[model samples]
Target: MTEMSSAPTVLVGAGNMGGAMLAGWLDSDTDAGSYIIVDPSPSPTVQLLIDKHGLRHEKAAPSDVEAAIVVLAVKPQMMETALPALTGMIGDDTLCISIAAGTTVSTIQSFLGDIAVVRAMPNTPAMVGRGITGAWANAAVSPAQRDAADRMLSVTGPVEWVDEEPLIDAITAVSGSGPAYVFYLAECMAEAGRRAGLDEDIAMRLARATVSGAGELMRRSDDPAETLRKNVTSPGGTTAAALDVLMGGDAMQDLLTRAVAAAKKRAGELAG
Candidate 1:
């Protein structure tokens, strides 16, 4: 494995997503001594990890240390307030990776100045080590730095790299916000089942299990989702009847397309 760097990695937040990433790093056997956590008020879970690993912790970015890698996991609205203190930790070779949604690379550089920056979007499922990340690196990033970023980001799951920055917004619409969509699907499914005469608790259980099980099946299957759908759907059968409603005149497709577009548009607005 390539050494990430000799200098310590400065993590600027320890909220849910930040804590998840930190836990993944330690679980992957990353040197606990190599991290400097800079959260003012870490959650109990994060505090436990820090104490367990004996990692260095600080209420704010320390001026004495120059970071090789910096992970910004603060909220978008908090970036302005949080970033200024972190400027002292960045050096010429520092690779900054920001996972906060709607915060652009240029915006980060504005505070930290021109250095390597990789703007990434990772979903909530990362807390469970099953998330996917969409990442874009600026021109300043070196190959080694990019590889290091990939390794750190991939601890949760797959990392999808995009050539253009704008595509990150589209990814935000899809996978970044996709988990909530899945959850809402389960909600709708449960309600439908309840209306169809199943007991409320039983309907919810069925919906939850069905959604999660299907997701697992897709994860393990080599065949595409369409093929899997077709495999279970017999001609003139119950599955086909459901598909007729969902697929008829592209109803689902159009609805999802419009929904994704709206999300992407809002992401752009937030970035600005």
Candidate 2:
């Protein structure tokens, strides 16, 4: 188990992502006493965690204690109203990690007054401990603070750091919003299968299983995804016939490129 600082870690939200992080920290054997959950209305799962762990629960940010780290898990839309209330929890040495998408570091600093900050984008898969994070730290963050951010963010899955903050929008497009794209693919595949004469339920089941199984295979294998795709596509085989449509004239690539660009554009608009 990684040792946390003596000062408490203040969590500002207890919604899905926030609750998932709390679960991960507890499962990793972090000291329950070191956390202070500050949510007005925690979900049933979060409330159960609080009761079971005997953690300090507050309806709002407590003014009495300075936190070692404060995790901002509130929604981007709620950030303006929420951040001002938590300013007292920050100290000179405190590190603030914001997982609120499209809410820029400058926007956070506008309220918190230039403290060490790490802006992160984590996906829904975090609930299952399979998420990947893209993080960018401002100049104020020290090496130690960055390490702490990494440790905390890595609880769900791998954490990838970027030098430039604008890349976060790209990361958000590619991975943060990527899960929905995969789900859409599954939907499309299921519909196609149904049109091809399979029962709707069976088609959905097959699509779900294939997507999940393929994802698991990609996770466990050392080979690149391209290598795996080629390995499965025999000349003149069924898989090859399918790939001809997906890869032909880069049809799939062009479609995804346009999709990601649209997402990135929206992320920038949100940042503003």
Q: Give the 10-residue window scoring lowest on summed lDDT in candidate 1.
A: 1-10
* Candidate 2: residue 214 lDDT (0-100): 96
Per-residue accuracy of model 1 over 84-198 as CA lDDT, tens digit each: 9888888999999999889999999999999999999999999999999999999999999999999989988899999999999999999999998999999999999999999
**lDDT (Cα, tens digit) per residue for candidate 2, span 1-272:** 23446888989999999999999888886589989999999989999999999999999999998999999999899999999998898899888999998999999999999899999999999999999999999999999889988988999999999999999999999999999999999999999999999999999999999999999999999999999999999999999999999999999999999999999999999999
Model 2: number of backbone collisions = 0
Please provide the root mean square deviation of candidate 1 (C-alpha atoms, Å).
Answer: 1.0
Off by over 4 Å in 1: none
Q: What is the lDDT of candidate 2?
A: 0.93
Q: Rate the local accuracy (lDDT) of all candidates.
A: 0.93, 0.93
